[model samples]
Target: MSDIQLPEDDEEQQLYERETENTPETPLIRRSQSHESIISTLSAPPAYELYPPATTWSGRLLNFFRRIPTRFTQSSIALPTLSDDRADERSISSRFRIPQLELHPRIARWRYPIVGLCVLCITIFSFLLFCSIFFSPASLPSPSVPDKIANDTAKFLTLNIFMRPPGVKNNWSDYKDDRTDFIIRHVLPNYDVVSFQESFGFGSRRKDHLIRAAREMGYNHHVESGRKYPWQIAVDGGLLVLSRFPIKDSRLIEYPRGRHSDWMARKGAIYAQIECKPNSLVHLYTTHAQASYQQITSLWDDDVRTRMNQFSWLHSLIAETSGKDGSAVVLNGDLNVDAAVHKEKSSPTEPSEESSEEYEFMKAVLSGEGKKINGKVEYEDSWKIDLKDAVYESYGFHPVTFGDVKVDEYGMVVPAETVLTDADELMAVQSIDHVLWSPRQSNMNIEGVRVEKFMVADTHLDNDEDEEKGYTQVSDHYGISYVLRL
Candidate 1:
């Protein structure tokens, strides 16, 4: 061993042994101890096969094409061995295996419940649609026309029809075609002239339907206010006048100022000269003034200020056009000005009070009291002429035309607010809708032309059976109608 002179390290020793000993050089590739050939390395799984296949076929195919270079490089390492029995099967399975989704246990458990919920929603929607189409309310039978009245007598009505646009939510109800149709068929035929405020939703299906129905019912002549400005987004003023009589001339005068959302629509009055009979012309004016909300308690609210401005403008219009040529002036509208609001006492220190300054001012302005526009034209609230005494004696004052009342499920008239109990309490709320007229001459006003028929229309729901308990009006305000004997 010492003479062998081993090299400094194992490298020199291996070199000496290989050179000195008679041996054959090993081949570049050799078999492993387990007899597995080096070529088996090429049969290993491709790069993409390490992860599970994508759920979608398109995704799987995309992965296949995207990893082609990686597969090619891996396969190029060595050729497949002919000795391997499952080589082709392994290759085909790895490249084209179908995906298997692996959903969590919790998600799979709730799948049926989610599907059932979707089905339930779809069923409810279909049922609502079916009810809306088939079970709709039909129009009531038309009432017979009244017998021909004296040539000098004329009938007029004012109503806030509540034909607001769709999608708006209110305290009473949504817009109903049956109510509108009922008014057109039954209410309008009984009167010579009708003025409607809040007859909004111009060009909508509801408005168009009402117009068509009115025309069919012999209300051929009509007039409405125009837009306040050309570039406005809101519809035209919500005032509409439908008359069986012939209209000689008509015009709309929009107020220069509006408050709150009232500015969106052109709020104004419709002035029409309607011939009630042969050579008997009546100057008719219909308007919808600024609206004050339920929360308002002060007389100096913005809505009040806006209404005062409109009132002044209205006075000017009547003074300029009405009471001329001996034509009778009739003013009809939802004034939104209550005659009085009775506030109940809260404690011993507090006392009940009634506020009515707005109502007083409105009367003064219309009657030419200190206002320059009222020099020639003077007006009087028609309800106060003759019916006031009877109304006062029975109910203490004129009943409210506007109140928080609605029909319950059982079709009973009930107060919407919890503070009130009986529907009669509504009479104490306040009176806003009215009919005011000035005499053909102040001398002949009270003597000749009285409110012959001072009646309230639509005081009960159309199909209500209990008149005493179910005295619900279709609109938010009651319809006021009267007969004028000239």
Candidate 2:
């Protein structure tokens, strides 16, 4: 740096010039240290500095943030130099309000818990609504079809409908709509007479629902097996018949013996005599024999025995009731008797007329092989007969395998897994739901029943919805509709 020469009034300037020019200067007299300090004593006070001594980058940032307000900080230790009322008079623009200022420690602590509670409340409410509507329980309704199917001897439908009693099972999860609405919308509109097994009416309002719905749908003629008043009937023998034509007569017969859960309801048969035409009367036997041989079965041996016993009663009832007349008779129901599908090792893919032990009992009544058991009335299965005929043989039937890949139930194809069993092929491909007819007594060789169209209605292909475990398919069993010409 260059030296600064003070204007020291010639004497100090000449000395500085002489020193810089390399010339010797005269020596000044030395004064005493205390006396010179005292003589030169007083100096001016120092001036204020514009900026503080913060040199490094971090130091500069610390100084800058120290000037900000403390209300914006949860802990102001980072800016300890900042005062409480820093910029108290500054006006914050309304558009730039600070949300962090309003955050409370307590509210922050419970924030997630409160949100979780709200979500839980919504989920519970949704579940309740689902139960009350889709799954809650069960119904019936009006018909749009004519009172009688014209010119046909028998136009009928039979289904199990899986009408389990209210609150007894988890039906709330299995169905997407009320069973009555489903029947009115899907099942009843297509057939003349719809017969349902397991239509229990003991303590619940379902029986009333069906009657009311049926009447509304123009199916004014309907009957129940029996009513115990409040609790008289066992588990509601659950047999019901709804007909478009007038039901001239109706009767109920509860079996004497039922085992296990069968004891819950008096399992039985119900039949009705309908006037199909002026001179031609049709005896419609709508019956549901006992079946304790379900996948969810208990007391297997006892259930089997009980089911057979029930069938015997059913046999006797049909024999006594069915007359050897020219009038037509259709015994249709969830008979729970499949002649070909009993053996665990049987391939379901093969549709053969294979008989199980229980099938013999049913065969005796239907085929008139009961030479010892009165040998009076003989009946015929509509499907087996239809297969032999030319015109109506093309129609299809499907077994409701719950979730298994399906096959035509009318012995059309064999199958793999079904809803009830893990076996690769089902025992047989036919439905427990059966449709049988009594041949014209005039000619023993002529069953006299021609199936124009025999269909397993509301089979898996009928619905657009997936068979979700908790909510799809109104019943485990599909409905059956048969157009018969006798």
Candidate 3:
């Protein structure tokens, strides 16, 4: 390149300076000052030449508004102030356009990651909401009935169905919906009277399904133990009594004492006077007593005392109601009192003093042996009657109604494949489930009562096959049934 030479005259020097300031290498301050000097050279004009008065009122009002300053014009980006002589033939947008804002470098770098995190959070929340709606009991469909129905004339059944509330650790019965389906289709149709314990749930949940199913299967009469508030004491005494026979009267009596979590349950007895025949009435009582919780042999513990108190209360209720009428009275439920001389949890060989006392006291109360009543009547345990017969000796020890399968610490029943000892079998068969009956003493219309059949019916879910892969029980306690001849 050739060396640059300085301009000699004043006009030539001024023109050279302007050209130098317009170059790309020159700073923006020099260029801005040059534009300001050019604008200052324009001559001042008359008000009519600057802005002519509008011909119409509306046009004049619009012209007035155009003169007012706006936020956009007041911003840091200075817009050119054009006079009439300098105004160009350009659109309003081109004349005054706002520049786009640029994000900071740090914020722009994390844009994609932030968007991805937000999407993931929304997806997880949607999935949780779907699961809560889909798995709820209210959303479940009714169970289908089998074509082969098993209906008997007169039979009695009692079981603890173990229907706990959902979302709890203790709601451990696997395939709970399937188990309930089996009961409605196969079991309820065969029995004349059915009583269930531990049917716990809220609103139209598991228990409501059974109620609707039973009513459809001709079990029209039903009674549930009343509910209690949290402040009053506990929830409902989870008892549901169903009968094909017409029920004349019904009452529930909750025990005053309890132990552990049993204190939070409405554990009690339910009494129902049902018409077995057109003119023949039967007094039915169902109850669920205090749980042992692996401490069955402790006679001096709070569990034992609470149980004793419940028994006494039950005895008084029976004496006051059916004892005076001399009607056919039948008591069936989970009493939590084993008939065995010794319990499995205690010394295997040594006799349990608690068991002996419980058995004797239970028998005395049922038979009205010591308590003075208006009409003294005797009641017999149906299992004892059936086992005492010489012909029925091959029937073996009493059928194991509960604990054949163990429940883990979280209240889930162990699998059927879990091997149990001989002592376990011996103890389980002598469980607390029982049925006691007393024929009417003064009524000639009623006949003598005899247990034609006694069985611990399997309440397991069947798949309609002879040999199955594994056994799945409906509840911890088996359903005990009695086919009676009256």
TM agreement with the true structure for every prediction: 0.55, 0.53, 0.55
**Candidate 2 local lDDT, 7-71, one digit each (tens):** 55656656656666653333332233222332343221212223475889987856554433333
Q: Which portions of model 2 show Cα errors greater than 4 Å?
A: 1-149, 170-172, 229-233, 294-301, 342-350, 365-368, 371-430, 442-470
Candidate 1 local lDDT, 1-486, one digit each (tens): 656765466656567576756743422221241124434543577777777779999789667655744533442334434333443333432443345444467865675576568879999888767544433322433423332323766667788877765554354445356567557655766777788887764444565566567766766777866522222466667788887777889888988657676767678888998876666667788889887754456655778767877876777777677635657677878888886555554321221244377776566655555222335433333222111112223334445666544567997765543321224344335567766666654222312222211122433335643334221345656667666665
- Model 1 pairs in collision: none
Ranking by lDDT, best first?
1, 3, 2
lDDT of 3 by residue, 197-316 (tens): 877643225677887888777677778777543335565667889887778888889887577778777789999988766656678888989977665654556676577678767766
Q: Local distance difference test, per candidate? A: 0.59, 0.54, 0.58
For candidate 1, report its TM-score.
0.55
Q: Where does model 3 exceed 4 Å of error?
A: 1-153, 168-173, 228-233, 343-355, 366-398, 405-429, 442-471
Q: What lDDT score is found at residue 482 in candidate 2?
A: 62
Q: For model 3, what is the alpha-carbon lDDT of residue 357?
A: 62
Q: Per-residue error at 118 for model 1, in Å?
A: 39
